[model samples]
Target: MALPPRQSCVDHEEISLGEIKIKTKDPACMCEVEVAPQHCSVDIKSVVIPIYLKFVDVRCSIRFKTSTLCRGSSNIVGKEILHGVSGAVGPGQILAMMGPSGSGKTTLLSLLAGRSQTNLHSGSITYNDMGYTKALKRRMGFVTQDDVLFMHLTVKETLRYAALLRLPKKLSRQEKIQRADSIILELGLDKCKDTIIGGPFERGVSGGERKRVCIGQEILIDPSIIFLDEPTSGLDSTTALRILQLLHGLAQAGRTVITTIHQPSSRLYHMFDNLLLLSNGHAIFFGRGQDALPYFSSIGLNASLLMNPADFLLDLANGNISDTSIPPELEIKLIQSKGDSKVGKPPELAVQEYLVECFSSEVAFRDSSVDSPPHAKDVILPPRREWSIGWWQQFLVLMSRGFKERRHEYLSWLRVFQVLVSAVVAGLVWLHSSADSEKHLQDQVGLIFFISIYWAYFPIFVAIYTFPQERAMIAKERASDMYRLSSYFMSRTLGDLPLNLVLPLVFLLITYFMAHLKLTVGAFLLTVLSLFLIVIAAEGLGLFIGAVMMDTKHATTLASILLLIFMLTGGFFTHGLASFVKWIKYVSYTFYAFRLLIKVQYSRSQVYDCLSATGCKSIASARVMADVDLNEAGPMEDVFALLLMVVGYRILAYVALKRMNTAR
Candidate 1:
């Protein structure tokens, strides 16, 4: 069976920027699709539609400051990485950046995408004659090589959250889902739409499908210009080709797509409409992809028949080309030796200088214009509006996602069993101690300190992994203008509260009755409330540590050291120290929690036979409080301190996250 050739449903006609008029050859067969001035689409058939996108012409000469050790002196010297390298990527075209490592491919893409925070010595990046502002950045998307996704989320759920955060707030929930569905179909991910985006331990979609889902995420925003850094990295050859084909299709649909690729296949090399070849941060070639062969041939470096053009070009760029008369093995050795010799300059440096000179005389350079098209004058881009949803809405969405992620990650059966076992062990150790016995006072105090330590230590250690694990995702989403950092931080802090409180509540429930300290309802409730506050304070401390360190190992080590210091000074291991050092207990939340637990359990009680061997005596709870050096600090005062610590640490965490993100 043969498939029918697709026919155009509408007559081709040129439309101006503000006005679009479509004339159909057959009215009955055509689907009438209205177009908006801000964005327009012409439906060729029910299945194929091309967007009338605003063409973006990007031209920039970017540089960054770097420090190098001085040769003779101990001082550092500053240098520039990029040296005014410039090029343009026009609309409906795929501009592929190819070069060796450290060739500034990713740096150039970051600069063009307006995501770099490094110093720009001099450059101007404009879209359709307008300056590249925050407005334009929101309309563009940059997909990093590494896919940062919520592994617990399904493909559809992932796209839905992306749409909810990135799409205009005016869109209804159903509309956003529909948009996500459309993108899923376009990316050919409909089959795996229901599958979870699994991680190292879980089985789910293939690598190719995951990459497509990443692309689908960006496409949900309907960006006019898209930048991808090594989208084919870590994929098989067949998968890489399929990904390139998808990018090519997007370009054909009127998107200005730019990507950095390394060592592409021959078939993949031909897919690019334009090529930006670079060497040592210098432009070797920037023109049509087809012109590369002729350009190289004219320079007496013609590629052999059936040779991969990309490899040959890279070889030429890297100064590894050999004459036909020279043996290939000897030529490689000679090139290696030349690179090793450090007398005058490396072979690559000489090659870069030669290419830089040759590029000045290339026909592409002589004929190419870095100016915007004339039609850009009449084109009216829509006024830029906020791309994020409302604050409360962002909170709700992030809260939902956080809950789902924690449910899968932190609330496992192993975690539950560990908590239960620890609680049972603590209960057995301090099984039904009397509050009025002076001999049992130490045991009761130990039990209270252990309970405080359990609540404080585990939550802090568990939360140490929170920010580091999500740091990449936070950077990606923040770069995409998805939501405010405050909303995300607040929602995550609030959302995890329930789960954080659950284990502590369970531990207290088992220990409270088994130890049999206080039977009054008010006392039990106060104890529970105080323990909850302590857990929150511990969580905040963990968040602060994670945010400042941004590395799991470093944060965990620092947190362990800090927690150990707090535990030592928590009024359990030591009774009295120098006044100068005794103030350390004031800073430890464990001190307050332990003191409050003791006061709540033994307040208004009395202990008989306090004397060791001289005489019998009766001791009041107030005297016991004075003996512990907590007479001045009541239960309410400790509670207040714990509450303050919670708010203070969370605020500090927020500040740290903002600073780190800004620095990045």
Candidate 2:
């Protein structure tokens, strides 16, 4: 007998006369595994991944920590949420986790991704392969339930940046592009790869395209297991079927594909060979789909032949064991019987003994029961050298997105234009006035305080307006481990620069010219410098408040309260009244700086240019109490205070952000 033709590195095997060769491809791990068991063959020309998932355990949670405020609502009590549960998944087989809407099905997905941990009291999510689940996030890929996109970047750029941030340099230029192309086509995003993904603010790709792009990013890394929250959700029936077919393709090619889906159509249900039914955070049925009837029958429910067994299983799944539909005793007996089979034997026991025996020879995937690597640490973080793409790349991408987001709007310089108009008007009106009107002196004090308080609202708006929308995206991405919190903070701090710089510069140029009391070249420069510090303080304050508050309403209310405090203790409005709250002024950035700027610009009779906002003579008669020259208002006194405000608030915001952002 002749031997089979072999093109691979390994030697050939003796062949039957009518043998058929089949091939399959993997774009992420970048390899192919062939089989000749049947007439059909899948000859994979290329793949991106050479590795596959050894094991995967994802746990999604909705933490209801109900202390006092949220305790009464049945919705949020100590629901134990997705009760103590476990499932095993590897390559090739589809573990279709089926359940009702509130059965914690989605929560299980989130938990497996390790996105939520607080509401979850005790559990261990271990990925035997790829090594790190927490610190080394590059190893896992998560496709969230929503369509999140930048709206500015096209599908190609979106995947490109994600790959740049994830793939190592060793993955050559050609390799990266090839992998990206593979993922692009793999998800059927070829047509819309150049299209922009849309958001409410900007228009681009459709929902299905957006979801594919999100998945494309994870595929770029060649993760061991790919997790989808609900890939078929909201999609049309045809599109939904296609999405599942894509997942089916991935599983067949030897990549672990785990997804949480609601009740699917008969066509969709038939696609799944394995089933995991969850009810009330518990797994009631887990085994082959065909075995469902036998499994239920063993528990005393003889489901009629030709009946849609899923319906009976689901109907019984309703926790209504007390109802006659499923007598309480029978329900308890059924549940107890099922629960008893959950352990001792490995999860693979659910499959027939013969299938287990044949798995070793028939299965093409890397084993899921792989043990921990000898050098592995519990904390899974990448080495420092892996930054061919990472925070630095994302920082640049976010900053670019921020710029584009602003550019399409009425220019960021619009505020500057408004200030310039105000400056021209103020220069024309107050061309001459630097005299002894005590009433004028009092008016200036009120104006300064009002500006201090009013500008306080700007940073809050910047933080809240920008952050709330991003809150949803951040949570979604963080759950997938796409980027870290530190990177977002750093990017945001840098990204916010244009607005901060532009807004304050305009306000200062206008206000200084309008209030021309006295001016020196040194005083002019120092005033601009002082204005910058105030803006920095405000930005930090806004981020801090935004990070702690979940809702914009609460953030706005808190911001208003803080603004009142900044104005009162700022030494501009209530210097005398501050006697009761004097200590507040010491900690208030506005107080020290407001006092400093006024003293510097209004202390003496100094000559001024008409172009200067605060004109030729210092109103000496207002208060001769302090002869401290306008040029020498003593900045050292508040310099430390300004630094403290900036440094203190930023550190606080970053810390708060760390606790809040669990998406990455």
Which model scores highest in TM-score? 1
TM-scores for all candidates: the values are: 0.85, 0.71
lDDT per residue for candidate 2 within 564-618, as digits (tens), equals: 7866666543335535677776777667667666665655553224345564445
The local lDDT score (0 to 100) that residue 416 gets in candidate 1 is 87
Query: What is the lDDT of every predicted structure here?
Result: 0.74, 0.59
Off by over 4 Å in 1: 1-74, 323-342, 364-371, 379-385, 606-634, 662-664
The per-prediction tally of clashing pairs is 0, 40
Every candidate's CA RMSD:
6.4, 9.9
CA displacement after TM-score superposition, residue 517 of candidate 1 (Å): 3.0
Q: On a 0 to 100 scale, what is the lDDT of residue 162 in model 2? A: 64
Model 1: per-residue lDDT, tens digit, 1-664? 1112234334333332221222333232222244443333443222111222222222334444454556543443455556556667766789999988877888888878878766544555566666666756555778999988888899999998888888767568888888888989988899999999998898989999999999999888667789999999999999999999999988776678999998899999999988988777777787889989788666555655457889887876676555312234334545765766665556556556666667766643431354554444333334553645799999998999889877876678899899899988988888997644566776777788788898889889888888888888988988887888888999999999888778888888998889887788998988888888888999999999998999999999999999888888877776776788788889999888888777777644345445556444433443334434434445788888989999999999989988995423
What candidate 2 gets wrong by more than 4 Å, as runs, is 1-79, 82-86, 116-136, 151-153, 171-182, 190-195, 290-313, 319-398, 405-450, 464-469, 475-484, 507-526, 607-636, 661-664
The deviation in Å at residue 223 for candidate 1 is 0.6
